[model samples]
Target: MNNDLYQEDIKQIKQQYACLDLTDDQAAFLLRHQNEPYPTHTEYYLNTWEHHDYEDHIFQKILNTAQFDHYLERREARLATHIAFLKQQDEEIKRNIEYKKQLLSYYCHTYVPQLLQTRLQYPNPFFAHRSKIRYIKEEYSNCCKVWKLRVTSQHFRNCRNYSPQLFELHMLDLQLLNIMPDYQQFKADADMPTQTTLTFLLDKSRCYLADFISFFDQKEAEETRTKKDAAIAVFGKAATSGWHIEPLPESNEERSNRLLFLLLMIEKVPDNGQANSCY
Candidate 1:
């Protein structure tokens, strides 16, 4: 890589590894040694600490004193403890991430869609019309910028309105969907950025949407078949005609976003959608 390009790459890497609490020198060292293979970010951090040169000028000054040898050993012990803590934190973060993925998968495929279907089929005019909601956005930047949303639903006293950051979690899910490895690779042109990547990404997204449609069709058919067959037993030919549910025409992205929004609202106000919030 060219010098400027390498520096940019280093900046990105530093952002990626920032959670490790890397100092400036350590961050630079990581960039320099990145050419060597490391299986994971944790391993890279561990190896960086292991091979770190303590003979630098900064350490040399402290090492020049008679009692410095004892202090150096104590400092090394503290550093070891800090590294262990970092590793422990890394493991904890991984666990939380896996749990988050499981929650998103369940909500996306089952809970959210199920609730949305129910709400669509059985509209609650009273609460639906009366409920008021407010949301605030918190934004941040790192390797990439994104928004964190906090939504509040208000209604009658003692009615459950919000479940803490649920909307933000859904927002995070949408963001993750956009940055999947397959999606990101589809958005890039080899090693460089290009304006044409937008068109390429859209095309790839359309293809994925087509596949999702097929999957949804199969799932929908399987689900309806069982329910409709059961309905026919109760009401005979009347049930055979079905309820004639029709969703509006929309792109895959539009549909997903709408469904997620509905899901978030339903989650915020579980019953009848009625709220009695002051604001």
Candidate 2:
């Protein structure tokens, strides 16, 4: 692994590749990499001066010359390999970048605006969702529309308004309750309001586990279809408006309860949206 085994060969290699103007460094590179693979650069470097016991001055004279000495054949080959890898994975890298970019755009334009909507003296279906009479809306309207509700988040610097970050965190909490052995008991605990709590759970009866567990799925489908019809009547034009009613992702009892929780929260918001509004 050290230069000891390669000590004798260094001179021989320099002599063989001399036609290519090999330096002591280049000869050492050729001697070590003659096998053409070392898992990666780490493995190749690990077997260098430390393993070889070559004197510091001797080793320094012949270490990694290809980076500065372009004449070294390995330099061109390494660059070519890296460029080829970049080209090969370009599409995947682009998709990943684009996905994050879209998430940021959503955060800026949709999520943050909703949280601050109440302070803007706005009405339901947020002002930001529009552009000069456009019916701007949030992406997911299947559940209790947070933009249409008055939820609070204590974690985010004591925020109190329509907020999706709070909404998602609440959703995970609901999912947690849904998977528990005594889910109803946990759901009940989440329902009971605590003094000084930012969030107030309302209409806890609607979120009863029995409704989802005992009811036939056909009944749920029928209700879903009816809601879709109403949504079409409200925000039908896909070309202009950004909403259409569709099936919620396949959900369990927990998701059903989550939707019920959102609905109850929306219902709890006062009817007087503008008159003496919080904004």
Candidate 3:
């Protein structure tokens, strides 16, 4: 791409754009960028002079100034195009975030809680017509009503009937074994755990049939926190470069996580002007 024959083109362009008032350094910069597809002033200056052939006066005579001017015009147009693209991308990202937030909120607060209530009401929906199952559902509902009222009371831990076994029994009656492709294996597992009263079994069964509402809610919070970390990492680089980066649309969980990160970082940073002065 480098040829000494472009000297004639440079002379003619130098005469035309004399009023450009470009310094020798600027001229050298323009020369180096003449061949670039989309050059930026920031990139041009950021590179070391040692990396430039013009610093050794190699390009002073042969560089095409007219092509350099065209490059600058093209670079400006390219930058404008990139900014427009970024704005469009940001708007799309914002819309997606809002949609996800709404979905997460609905799943956590309304859909899941109602689903849990439905499960408790008809643990064996397939056999819900039977009088025996109906009686069990009624008794379980009575227990749940009592459990809820006493849950916030001081004697919650002392209540003998507030058992995890109640939850486990309800889960077993849900006919989860029938739904499995390997029903025999699951039925075998279902029979063996007939004696255990561990909370883990209750949690596992609940999670398999219908995930625990609290656990789903916790996962939603964790997802938001992950998003916050990503946003911070993205925007922090823009901040250091003196570019104005827009904050991403965040859920309450995301905002809280972001604030927590900011507070922790602030505490870690030295109060004194000097770096590493915190010791």
| Least well predicted 10-residue stretch by lDDT in candidate 1 | 133-142
Give a tens-digit lDDT track for model 2, residues 42-160: 22343222333332333345544543343335435654665455445443343334333333333334433343342233232222222311210111221123322323223222222
Task: Name the best candidate (by TM-score).
Answer: 1
lDDT of 1 by residue, 1-279 (tens): 798987787777668655444455655665666666756662133332343343233344433353345545655776677656655544444433443454344445554455546545434331332222112000011112221221122211111222223333444444433222122322232223332433333333343343234445555565455444544544454644434212245786755433332322343322322121211
Give me the runs in candidate 2 sitting further than 4 Å from their true place: 1-74, 118-279
TM-score between model 1 and native: 0.27
Name the candidate that leads on lDDT. Answer: 1
| Regions of model 3 farther than 4 Å from truth | 1-63, 92-94, 111-279
lDDT per model, in order?
A: 0.40, 0.37, 0.37
Residue pairs in collision within model 1: 154-277, 155-275, 155-276, 155-277, 156-275, 156-276
Clashing pairs in 2: 2-52, 3-52, 129-136
TM-score for each candidate, following the candidate numbering: 0.27, 0.24, 0.22
Of 1 and 3, which scores higher on TM-score? 1
Candidate 3 per-residue lDDT over residues 1-279, each given as its tens digit: 345545544554456446555445555555556656755673243222233324235434434686455545654665566556644544545433443344334434544344445445534532323443234233333433443343423222222233333333233322111111122222233323321321222322332333234544564565455445444554433332221223356685444433322111111112221112111
Report clash pairs, candidate 3. Answer: none
Candidate 1 Cα misplacement greater than 4 A, ranges: 1-57, 97-189, 192-279
